[model samples]
Target: MTNINNIQSISQILDSQSTKKSKSSGPAQGFESLLNSVLEKTQESEQGIQATELGEIPAMDFDIQTVSSIVTDKTDKLLTSLESYAYKLDDGNITLKEIEPMLEELNADAASLLEETLSLGEDDQSLIDIARSTAVTAKTEYLKFQRGDYL
Candidate 1:
């Protein structure tokens, strides 16, 4: 009876030890391999980024002369239209209703011209100033006309 009890106790100790070894080694080995693979992928991506950084970037060529001309042309048109409108207002035959849409259009053009002026060179400043003043004058005349001050 004593020998049988001792054999059973020894068997239990062996079973517990084997279970502990499996629990410790199985997932740890798998996790270590996963971490190593992730590090390798990161290193590959870093090398690819460094290669791109060493490559030459292409230059962009553009001309502002055409753009400046367009702005100038638009500004000229705005000034012409405003001058014509001022003459029409002075003639006093056109009504506020008739002038509304035309004034609105001129105002829109003036605003666009003003925005374009910001991108223009220093030499075009006088043209910008003229457009600005013309717009303001037109607006003032329109207000006066609305208030019956012209009559």
Candidate 2:
């Protein structure tokens, strides 16, 4: 009976030792390999990014003269239309009702053109104020005409 009890104790000790060794050794190899693979991939990606950026060209600057000429052409057309409308109004060929819608449309177009012509970082306050005033005047005249003030 004493010999059997000693053999059972030895077996239990050996089993616990084996369990501890397996638990420690099992995850160590897998974790080391995973960490090495992640580091290698990160290094490779950084090299690729640096190479791509070095191969890229710088952007060219835009031509200001070309842009200015285009803007001048558009402004000329808008002014011509506005002048023609004014003449028609003065000659009494067109009523306020007819001119009001056209003036509103022209005002909107002129405002858009002015914004586009004035690039970023430039002030266009005066031009915008003039456009707003013209729009208000046109609206007031239209309202007056509608109320039978023109007749």
Candidate 3:
């Protein structure tokens, strides 16, 4: 009877292990694939933007308001993405690898915006500097979380 009970307990444990593995496997793979796709697209988009090229002042007349609006829209998207990921992190669902790439993308977006803003006339410099500084500080905190040094 004791041998039979031990066998039953072992079977229960094996069943539990298999169940947990099966449950986690699909979601884990999906999350990893999503992260990969986001990273790849972000890198491609950043390359196409070429923030350095924006540094050159074009001879043609430009609308600063239109340019500022576009920059604000991109920055808002980056911030929104980071905020969503932070919620996932708070839930203990985000892995360090996932956080790192996302943080890097956010940093790049902020840097690109700053580069474009700096290319503008001196009148807009102060506001752009403030925005850039805030973004840098936010990115630093994000990096800490990604490194598991802070929450």
Q: How does model 2 fare in lDDT?
A: 0.64
- Model 2 Cα lDDT, one tens digit per residue, 46-146: 77745443355979998666544555555666666666766867877677767667766666666666665555223555554444455445445545655
Off by over 4 Å in 3: 1-65, 125-130
**TM-score winner among the candidates?**
1
- The runs of at least 3 residues in candidate 2 whose Cα sits more than 4 Å from the true structure, single-residue gaps closed, are 1-65, 120-151
Model 2 vs truth, CA RMSD? 11.2
- Can you rank all candidates by TM-score, best first? 1, 3, 2
Worst 10 residues of 1 by lDDT: 47-56
Which runs in model 1 stand beyond 4 Å of their true positions?
Answer: 1-65, 142-151
Preferred candidate (TM-score higher): 1 or 2: 1
Candidate lDDT scores, in order, read 0.74, 0.64, 0.70
Residue pairs with clashing backbones, model 1: none
lDDT of 3 by residue, 37-72 (tens): 878776776788554533568698876676566656
Compared with the true structure, what per-residue lDDT tens digits does model 1 show for residues 1-151?
9999999999999999988886786778799889998787768767774445435799899765765687778777877887888777667678767777777778678678777777777877776677667666666665665687755
